[model samples]
Target: MNLKSFPDEHLQSLTSLEYMWISYCPSMDNSFPCGLWPPNLSNLSIGSLKKPISEWGQQNFPTTLVTLILYGENSGAIPFAKADDTRNTATTSSFLLPPSLTYLYISDFMDMESLSMGLQHLTCLEELVIISCPNLKDLPVTLLPSLSRFWVNYCPKLRKKCSRKGKYWPIISQIPDLDILKAGRT
Candidate 1:
């Protein structure tokens, strides 16, 4: 039985990889390699893994990662703790995220808050979509200047607020160039 996670023996020569779908690897503890990646990797969709993302893992992510889609049952704060095993100490929040990321979609993250705030670092990000996150009450005001498209669906409680102009809107006016769709609107 082949228990190795990476199908290919070496990724050294590979310069670019597109649209990778990785799922259901029981022994795969970490997501990406510790260092080095496809220089042009853009679209990445990963799901169904046990190990959470560590602080060390974040510092070596692909700089070219553009669109990221994460689907899983692990819904909590961003999982990068100091000292790898210790969960108490507060470490510097500088994780190596994709610099060129444009779109991000996170589903079933019921209690996520920091991501909305941390995403301000992705200066090139344009669109963000979140669904089924019942615990998300407020979005950080920092994600406005460059974000153009925003969509939040199936979050019933998020729809009760009114815009600054007194119109019933789910998301607030903070989304500078948003194409917002209310629940009842077609």
Candidate 2:
């Protein structure tokens, strides 16, 4: 069922819920309801959310969450880095990813300019796929030691930086498998 607004008490009542998909719910407006995270939820997919994910703190999610998919259409940028005026690049740090998360897929994040350094904390993350995030320019690959598969599609700037001998190359070179596909190339 699809809803424009999800009541907190109703969500809290679904303790047994393991997976949830919310699409076209603009009323959610970027911030999920506080204290409504289902303890057993393992998979969550949100599409067309306007708010950047930086506002979602660690306490807002369930510890059991294992997979997260975020798809934004014309949504604003994701705050992933803090820029240093002296340097041309931004610093990466761990974001509020759930510890049990093993797979993460982000698509069409129009406002993402850089990856958050907080990504390093996803110790169990095995695969990360980013698609159609055109403005994303950097990745903190060194922090994600457990990542086995990395894929990028439709992100021209990021793909170039991850190229062999590129500035970001050495950091991601150790990953077991890497796929950098051009836009619309599948």
Candidate 3:
């Protein structure tokens, strides 16, 4: 279905919703409605969003969220503070994620260059998947102690960096399962 606008009242009423998938809705222009998300929401998937990742922050994210999936060719960067932004910058970013998150999937972001360091906050994250983002280049250096599975597909530069002998190997080598798919392969 085509949704042009999502009203706050409509979203606030789904207090018991656990999973929601909104895709193929090009007419929607707003970041997932802030402060209107149900407290019990655990999984959310949004596709074809034109808004920047910077527009979604802690306030909009449900603390109960466990999985997040974003797919859109027009999506923007995953906002995070720079490592050098502070003296003790190992964990400092205005961009906050819910601690309950376990899986994160992002795809088709044509303009993305790097993942935000803010992801380090997801201490409970177990799986991460990035697909079809051609411009992505780097990943955060912070260790994801709980991450057991990592997957990347159709990201040329990122694939090169994550190679066995590449610069990103040290960062991802600890993961129990790692899959890197080249272009044209599933």
Best by TM-score: 3
Candidate with the larger TM-score of 1 and 3: 3
Superior candidate under lDDT, 1 versus 2: 2
lDDT scores for all predictions? Answer: 0.54, 0.69, 0.71
Between 1 and 3, whose lDDT is larger?
3
Off by over 4 Å in 3: 33-35, 50-59, 80-95, 184-186
Supply candidate 2's per-residue lDDT for 181. 79
Best candidate per lDDT, number?
Answer: 3
Residues 72-111, model 2: lDDT tens digits: 7766555432222122222322135566789998898777
Per-residue alpha-carbon lDDT of candidate 1 for residues 1-186, written as tens digits (9 for 90 to 100) = 223366432443577565676655546555553435556668876644555433224333477789887655453544422222223223433344565889887666555544544455677878877666555555545554556777776544443333344333433466665544455311
Query: lDDT per residue, candidate 3, 119-170, as tens digits?
Result: 6566788899999888888776664435799999988888998888888887
Q: Candidate 1 regions off by >4 Å?
A: 1-4, 7-13, 24-30, 33-36, 53-56, 80-95, 156-186
In model 3, state the lDDT of residue 123. Answer: 72
Task: For candidate 3, list the clashing residue pairs, or say none.
Answer: none
Each model's TM-score, in the order given? Answer: 0.64, 0.77, 0.80
Q: What is the C-alpha RMSD of each candidate to the true structure, in Å?
A: 6.2, 6.3, 5.0
Clashing pairs in 1: none
